[model samples]
Target: MRILILGGTGEASALVRGLAGSGHAVTLSLAGRTAAPKPEAVPTRIGGFGGPEGLARYLTENGVDRLVDATHPFAARISRNAAEAAAMAGVPLLAIRRPPWERQAADAWREVGSVPEAVAALGEAPLRAFLTVGRQELAAFAAAPQ
Candidate 1:
């Protein structure tokens, strides 16, 4: 069976390595957000499939038997596109969703709607903040006085 994995995260890379020599033909797809992405064990494709329609077309044309969504949690658009495309192409789809971080007794967490909201939660005071929203969203926190 031919498998297409929508990948970018470390989990995706690990999955590709694990599937090596598994008999199934596997291909990993990256969104091309990084200038230089790490090589994968399986065949790799870069950039978007345009959207749901384009992805469906590619799945049909390439004869993909299965689809795996290993994209980042914040990549809502791509995830939706993958689901829609998988349905349209009549291909089986699987999602690798990571479990949420478990909070410890000493951990203090505040949930916010967006990056700006997260920044605003810091208040007007100049405080050191550690941003972990990913490389693409780093610029959004630049205006924060922290």
Candidate 2:
């Protein structure tokens, strides 16, 4: 079976390692955001697939038997594209989903579902915040003069 894994995180790397010598041809795909990504056990492809349609094209062209979305939890766009592309190309998709991180009593975290909500939650104070949002959503938080 030909498996194309959308990978970037440690779990994705671990998955690829676990599937080694499993009689499956696996290819890992990265977003090329990092200048130097750690090496993998299987063949690796770095870059985007344009969008859902482009991903579908790649899936069909490459004769991918299965697609595994092992991207970061924050990579919503990539996961969405993978789902749509899998449907479009008639390929099976396996998503490695991780449960939302449970906040410990000592953790100071405010979870917001949307960018606007995140901005609102930040309030108008000029305080520092450790944000884990995507690049597209970064601009929303730029309103903070801090």
lDDT of 2 by residue, 1-146 (tens): 99999999888999999997899999999999989999998999999999999999999999999999999888989999999999999999999998877778887998888888988898877878888776657988778766
lDDT of 1: 0.91
**What is the lDDT, from 0 to 100, of the residue 133 in candidate 2?**
76
For this target, which candidate reaches the highest TM-score against the unseen true structure?
1
Candidate 2, overall lDDT? 0.91
User: Please, what is the whole-model Cα lDDT of each candidate in the order they appear?
Assistant: 0.91, 0.91
RMSD of every candidate to native, in Å, equals: 1.3, 2.8
Indicate the residue-level lDDT of 100 in model 1: 78
Error of 1 at 120 (Å): 1.2
TM-score of 2: 0.79
